[model samples]
Target: MIKNVEIRQALPADAPAIEALYPAAFPDEDLVPLVRDLQELAAISFVGLANNGLVAHAAFTPCSLAGRGDNVALLGPVAVAPDRQRQGIGSALLRAGLRHLQNAGTGWVFVLGDPGYYGCLGFKPDDDVRPPYRLPEEWRGAWQSLSLSEHKTPLRDQLTVPQAWRRQALWTPYGL
Candidate 1:
């Protein structure tokens, strides 16, 4: 982990820095545009800053189940500066983002990512709420959820993500 790393909400002024981060953080993937779209759409994002500059970013946005009233959100496109990967910065920033969501009373959050990584963060395989698109069988376990509510039960309905996350491409694990 980087010492003295500060975690805070990403601001409009940090847009350029965040834009610069994804390319370096995810060299094999083109995530700059995704992050840009999410930010422009007002996703709740958090940034980790060190003495060097912006080193990490994670975003969250509202999602809901059809015909149900629930406070749900989606976590995605998390990036850590390539040099900072696996050093705990990603997890720290994500935890910070989750804390913000919990404080805002978000009932549930879902993500499609490495089960091992997200599992360590308290996410569990989510069987109740289905993704906007069916995941490949291999990735079924990667589609996970974390309950922020005391009830800890899914709405038992389909998930609806934000506009920036509606793409079928994002729902699949192919590009990663």
Candidate 2:
């Protein structure tokens, strides 16, 4: 059973455990390197621990909108150990991580995740903020945003993300 999970910023020493969590949670994909690259690129990473062991992780990386000067971030690669799924660990990690970014003065955060899940966290599909690449119509709905402090100002410019996320395939669901 999931125990008292603590959420906190990830440290360099947590790399090995964080790396292992990715592949174990997503066996069909090789996302360890991507996550590592994000870490190397200075993404804000957070981990959830229970019994002093890493159980969940979430990463938020920098992104920009053409012609607009507000601070923005991309959220992805959130993972929970297979054994820890559906136990609220992921949600707790996300809430804590988002709070970190918001307090850091981030104006907005974008994510491509399940509407049912992220929607509950105040994320909503926003066609206004265009991604750098074209997404399949079927998956367009997955692009969502959450303005910090519940701001309603819509972003209507092309979004630019980190080099690792430049791959067109990365714009799809679970493409990390």
Candidate 3:
């Protein structure tokens, strides 16, 4: 059974656990460096804790829509410890991060994740706002977004992610 996990903003000291989670959750991909890079880029990070240890992590970094300013946030690289998978920890972290973005005046948040998973959290495939880089044909629908502002207007521009996230190789259907 999935027990309640306390989600909270990650502090500087939680960096090690955050980095470790990537490998624990995704054995093949060494995303520890990417997590640190996103953190260095000032991404808003959060951690899910249960039984007195970190169980999950999620980050929201700034992104822009072509001409428009940085009013958008990119939610990604969320990971849950292997042992904590399917325990609702990832969802808890995502919900907390979205709440944080909403309170911080962020208008929209985009994610390239499982359609069904993100759909349950109110994200939908947005034909209006496109990703910074072209994704594979099969992965097109994976690019989804959620409106966190009071006004739920349709997004209308191409995304411009941070330099670190601008890599075309990063836009793929391989791993969420």
Predictions in order: lDDT:
0.86, 0.86, 0.84
Give the lowest summed-lDDT range of ten residues in model 1.
167-176
- Rank candidates by TM-score, best first: 1, 2, 3
**Model 1 misplaced regions, further than 4 Å:** 174-176
How many clashes does the backbone of model 1 have?
0
* Candidate 2 residue lDDT tens string, 53-134: 9999999987889835669998988899999899989988899988889999898899887888899899999899887788
Whichever of 1 and 3 has more lDDT, that candidate is 1
lDDT of 3 by residue, 1-176 (tens): 24667888999999988887888887986778778899889899989988888989989998888856858999888888888788787887888889888988999999987898899999998778888888777887899999998888777879888777866656765564
lDDT of 3: 0.84
